[model samples]
Target: MASTDMRDGLKCSICLSTSTDPVMLRCGHNFCRVCIDRVLDTQDESGVYSCPDCREQFQERPALMRNLALRKIMENFRHTKPHQKVIFCTYCVDSPVPAVRSCLHCEASLCEKHLRAHSKSPEHVLSDPSTSMEKRKCSVHKKILEYYCTEDAACICVSCSLAGEHQGHRVEMLDKVSEKKKEKLRNIFQKLTTKREKTKEKVRSLEERWRKAQETAAKEAERVTALCTDIRRRVDDLEKKVLSEISRQEKEESQSLSALIHQLEIKKDELSRKMRQIEELCNMTDPLTVLQEPDTGDLCDPEEEEGDKDTRGHVKPLHDGDDLDVAVISETLSTLCDVITGIRRGIYVAGSSEILMDVNTAANNVHVADNLKTAIWTRKNENRPETTKRFMCNQVMSRRGFTSGRHYWDVEGSRSGEWMVGMCYSRIDKRGRQSYIGYNHKSWSLWRYNNQYSVIHDSEVIQLPDKISSDRVRIHLDYEAGQLSFYELCDPIRHLHTFTSTFTEPLYAAIYVYESCATIFEDWLCNWP
Candidate 1:
């Protein structure tokens, strides 16, 4: 039996109570296994683990062996009479062992098994395993006090539930709060996922637009470059022609100068010889005999004045001669250059026009249906007077007018009467105007002047009453007779009207009436006598 002193009776670093299941670490320090496990479970901000007694660091999952002898001794002591007093659960007192270890702040006790289960449960309020024993606290309330009020953020002892503040508030076991928070977090994540998808769609749309714009810009750049290259090619051709023309002119001038020099030398030699002959003749003493002899030397003189005039007219000064031709050449070159410049300008203008036209056509070609689908349009009742009168007429005619054939009525009958059939027709009339005609068992009418009024008969004009319902009246037009007729029933004898119009283009008429008013129109159409 070792003496039970501070060294021998080492307390658990986690519970700060004497270690019952003592485990000796490699460093010779002893602690309850559960105590060290709790400490290891709690992670600090920096995540380092330290022993409480020696303040020494130990790796997670320390190489420790349990002191089985010490554990047995503690177990024996626990069984002693003084230590054997029953520890009953504060809540549900009938149970000897608690189901869970309530937080100290909440003042609940739990059995060993319950305590172990609760420690791992999300709803449990296990103390931070990384903290020192003295600093350990309930996870939910963070209170060192060994009691909890199950209601509303309150820390209380078992007797505190009856207090006024917590009297009505729903009290739940503190351990369940963690599970609730986790569930709430999951819901938040789900919502965030939906938002993320929407954001991704928007980003995708923007990226698509960016890609399209980039492609368009690239195409435009290519077109501009091609135009520039064509211009450069034309310029190069012009430059080459101009250089060739300059070289040809230089060669021609050199040949012309050589020919002129050769002709001048021959003229000079002839003039010198002729002068000598004239001098010899003058020196002769017997001039009459020399002239008469006509023998040895030539007696003719050179035409100096004529030759000098010809040479002066034919030969040009070197510097001045090229000036006129060069001026003409330069003017022609300048005109060609101007033409090329104009061509370049025109190309640019044409390209610009093409771009503008494309944009304009795209703008004009927008789909009407697509625009309308997203827009709300207002509909006004323009034929209120006619509509009211027609409705009344239809009701009366459908019930009283002659009926023929298998005519069906929709109103005042359910699967027992005939069904009403109707249609509407519209077309251009003779006066270059559009007309609408409606026909039914009750009556027939024409909408002329752009539906402003109804044409009832050929001889008489009648304005539709304001209270008449348009749905009650129907009209039919006969193109062969150039007449429009109305009927109250299928019988021809119940004719309502017959009107003629000076319409040239084919006219369309809409024949429609309420089922209640179909009897008269049906009888008229059936020619019932």
Candidate 2:
């Protein structure tokens, strides 16, 4: 019975009174089970609980040991300790425990009865500790960060959104912004890959074309070199043959002159000896006496007279001998000159001389042919209709056309806005009349013209309706197909009208248009030229 009373008399460390539903804390101290549990829960920080009495920490909520025997004994003797009501709080024990001790104001242990008495008093007010602590937290009041603006797909924060700078900007969560950027990066990567492949193909194609061009240039160079070489060889051979013929002719003339001089010298010598003998015979003094003496007289008399005549003839013509020799030498020199002149003529006639070639003329002809081919290729490959359509869509706000000295105008806005304009001429026909026509959007008029200076006609102005904005107008000319079309701005840029004709002399027919502003007719018309 005494042991039972002693067990019942054991006090709670928290209440400082006889155990009431007592619990053993991790420190082995006894307290009311609910009281210790509340203290343990309130004191927990970082998920660790500490004993109130010994301040010993526990890793987790320790197992609660209920003393059933002590509990039953205390139940039986509940009224025995009624006078010992002054209980100390285990957490704060300088004075008696408050009626409703709370952890809100201070870290103090609480008794069930303490809080009720404390609330009745004006000094203390019952407040939710959890709510008051949460109110003081900075994280709850802080605004979340917005990292992306969805309008332009930009990155920004919450402060930027509230500032009027991003009034209409759509914002996205920061976490999602990274994903969006990553997706964009992936798309860019794909585009880069595609571009890389395209560039590689282009490079390879260019390399192949370069190789082919190199081969062509090499072959052409070789051919040109061979032609030049062959020509030079022929010229050299001709020159050599000409020189040889001249030399051979000169040698033959020299040999013939020497032979003629030798023959003339021998004949002159023979005539000289005969004249001497005749002179000797004619000089005899006793010719008359001898004529009567013998047969020799008759012969001597006739010979003497003939010899005197022959001597006179031989001595008579010594004046013209040098002149005859000079004539023969001049004839030989003239023949040599004629042979040299003929050789020179033949050399020039061969056409192998460098001076005959006009390199600049040949190069110019080649250049002209290349230019024509390039022009033809450009005209064929370019889409004239599509280009014209694009031009129409992008026309200036004001323009004009002239016909018969009369100016027509197409205008959009007052002189305040921007403008653009274009004009083009097509090829002409044999009739000398202007067969090609071009339309201007600003004046809503068409002007027909020739490739030369003549302007055929300008159509009457077709005013644009207010509902149809000039910015939305598009014109297309298909000279090859002999078709003209106008389109309104829509999904497909709706065709307003189309004109088809069989006449196709014009290589290209074009139109001009306007959009935002109007100007003087002079300003617009001056643009055509």
* Model 2, span 1-529: residue lDDT tens: 6755675458776776777777676567767888888887786666878887788888887767887777776787765654423434434456555333344334334567554444354323234323232222223223233456778665554566766466567787767878877999999999999999999999998897689668757965895686667566665666666566667666776677678778768956866776675666567778875355434333343234444355455433212333234444445445555554554433222111111111111111111122211100011222232322222132211111111111122222222223222223222111111222333211222321121111112332333232333343333343333344454434544445444444323222122212222222112212111
Per-model TM values vs. the true structure:
0.33, 0.27
RMSD of each: 29.3, 35.7
Name model 1 segments beyond 4 Å from true.
1-191, 275-324, 335-529
Stretches of candidate 2 exceeding 4 Å from the true structure: 1-170, 275-529
Which ten contiguous residues of candidate 1 have the minimum total lDDT? 352-361
**Across residues 1-529, which tens digit of lDDT does each residue of candidate 1 receive?**
3434643465666677878678876777778888776766773544677766776775554566998877887777656554223544444456566343444433455566556544454334444222132344534344442344554566443334445345555555445765776899999999999999999999998897688658747965896687777777767767777777777777787787777778778867877887877678778899686678556444343442434334455534323365225864575478576756665453322111111111111111111122211111113222333322132121111112211111121111112222222222221121111111233222234332222234433223465433222322333443433444543332223444455443444332222122111211221222222
What's the TM for model 1? 0.33
